[model samples]
Target: MDAALADCRACPRLVAWREQVAREKRAAYRDETYWGRPVTGLGPADARLLVVGLAPAAHGGNRTGRMFTGDRSGDVLFAAMYAVGLTNQPTATHRGDGLRLLDTRVTAPVHCAPPDNKPTPDERDRCRHWLVTELGLLAPTVRAIVVLGGWGWQALLPALTSAGWQVPRPRPKFGHGVRYEIAPDGPGRSSLHLFGCYHVSQQNTFTGRLTPAMLEDVFAQAKSAAER
Candidate 1:
């Protein structure tokens, strides 16, 4: 799936943008080769906890080829995860940075990095199948999911439903620290605990809207929920 995801060029706009950024190259990363493809989810398949974000950052995951790596958002996120014992390291600079998630996997709704960090509705819809497939694969052991920001939260709920969980009428709204228990609609399926957290974006962190403590609290709750 990872290989197939990497080779995907289903969205022409995303394909053009990602490759353009990769070719132009951020001045700081000029010497390095960018992955320039859809970044795949990280961590083991049997992970109990899942972290969902909007998409890859242009110079962050797009350059480093891993979700939440080589960016300020990743710095804030990985630090909080490490503090809560969800990862082995607090820093994720590159793919070979020796960082390891502890029974936790991090992924995104859109695999490719979009212009201005925002993917169009059409692009998001085109990429939805990948997330649905990933969720289906993780269904057995993934008991909890922490969706960062409302974009991810909105994108994830429908995917969750397609993956076998039943979403309630009117849908659940996204907010910091919101939690919802979604029952599996199929036989032999496990119930899932959904959590919401502010995205660890520089916009949020820079303004103190999402502090280390606040993020840590969310992860701690998610870790506990996953254990149950």
Candidate 2:
């Protein structure tokens, strides 16, 4: 995650976008300093499920220096993790919150915050290599993944497909609760599943597009897949 954070010069546009967001403080965010820098994602090294998100929020994780750590998204995410017994710390506001991930870990397609909360295709593509490496590292014990949006799912699909994970036909398009099992790689635990959920961003939750139940159901499926 650190290496990816450091080497992420992916989208020139995003690099520029981050710089701009860092420069101008919107009226609503007077007290907040935008963490335009790459956000460090957190998860267990031996986690069973990997959750993927779109990107950091300009004032949220981007400001907090930890992926999904200091935002409304983190609030919903950790709340669900605690509900599922997947997180030791009930809340994660800072990097030093003594929080720990249990069976799940969260990541994003891009490491930096994209202005207006949009990651360019180039940025997502560029970041794919790191995710591929991460998947390779995590695949041994990982049973499933929960993609938080269509963009995240698209960003991750290539790597999973290359790894021989199958996408069910009449194909499961991106949406909350959809699941796919990556074909078994070998004699040893070979299946990996991809589950879909709406991005737990401020827009979704604040706008009531997603709620605690929506978020919990995704993790519930993940818990089930991990246990199976």
Candidate 3:
């Protein structure tokens, strides 16, 4: 699945944009070869918890080849995860940084870095299959999912339905610390706990919209829920 995802070129616009960024190169990353392709989810298949973000940062995951690596957002996120015992370390600089997620996996709805950090509805739809497939595979063990930002929250709901969870009418709204328990639609499926957190973006963190303590609190709740 990872290999197939890394080689996906289903979205033409995303294909061009990712390659162009890799070719031009960010000045600071000029010496480093960018992964350029779609970034895959990181963690064990049997992870009990999941973290979903909007997409990779242009120069962060696209350059380092790992989600949440080489970015300020990741710094804040990993620190919070570590505080809640979700990770082995509080720093994620690169793929080989020896950082490990404990009973947790991180992924995104859109695999590639989108322009201006926003993906078109069409692009998101095209990429929905990957997320649905991932969710189906993780259904057995994943009990909780923390969605970072409204975009991810919105994108994830439909995929959850597709993966066998029943979303309630008048769909749940996204907000910091909002949580919902979604019942499974099938015999073999299990209920899922969905959580909302402010994205660990500079816009949120730089302005103190999302504090470390706030993020940690959310993760701590999620950790407890996952373990239960």
Candidate 4:
């Protein structure tokens, strides 16, 4: 996975798009490496409670390399994770920023920056293979998964469903703190607990759609469910 991300050239369009953004937004991340390349997964490779986010923002993950860093969404998400004891760091401003996870790990469906914050269906399809591979490696030890938005939920459904688990009728519709069980495909394997929440994007916060308290409550629930 690390090698794939480090040398990612999967989406030429995204590669060109990111380089353009870097050139135009040069001053913004002048002092930083502009992680404009691909942002592989971050956090412990074996930690439980994996967080599935949508994708990296041009200036956020694209600039910082660390998921959910250097942007408004990251500011909101990390604060809540800190409050719930999920992360050791309270802020995520840049890579090598001393940020660390406690019981949670984070990843995205698309590892590379997409054009205009949106990836085509084909792009997403190509990216899901990494997600599937990561899921299998992380699933055995993970207790719960916190999927940030509806797209993330949809991307992962097929994998869980094929494993003989009844994924959610009407499919676990997205809403903060909504939890469901991914019944095991095997006789004795543990079930995968799933939770949903907003993506913590700037629009959601600035528009008054999701407040700090609301986000915090969802994190609390995720932690408790993770422990259970």
Q: In model 1, what are the clashing residue pairs, if there are any? A: none
Model 1 scores a TM of 0.99
TM-score of each: 0.99, 0.87, 0.99, 0.92
> In candidate 2, which residue ranges exceed 4 Å CA deviation?
23-35, 168-171, 185-189
The candidate with the higher lDDT, 3 or 4, is: 3
For 52-112, candidate 2 gives per-residue lDDT tens digits of 8888887677666778887778898889878978888779887677988887778887888
lDDT of each: 0.94, 0.77, 0.94, 0.79
lDDT of 1 by residue, 1-228 (tens): 888999999999999999999999999999999989999999999899999999999999999999999999999999999999999988999988899999999999999999999999899888999999998889889999999999999899889888889999889999999999999987656998899999999999999999999999999999999999
Cα displacement (Å) at residue 71, model 3: 0.7
Residue ranges of candidate 1 with Cα displaced over 4 Å: none
Residue ranges of candidate 3 with Cα displaced over 4 Å: none
Give per-residue CA lDDT, model 3, range 40-138, as digits (tens).
999888899999999998999988889999999999999999998999999999988999999999999999999999999999999999999999888
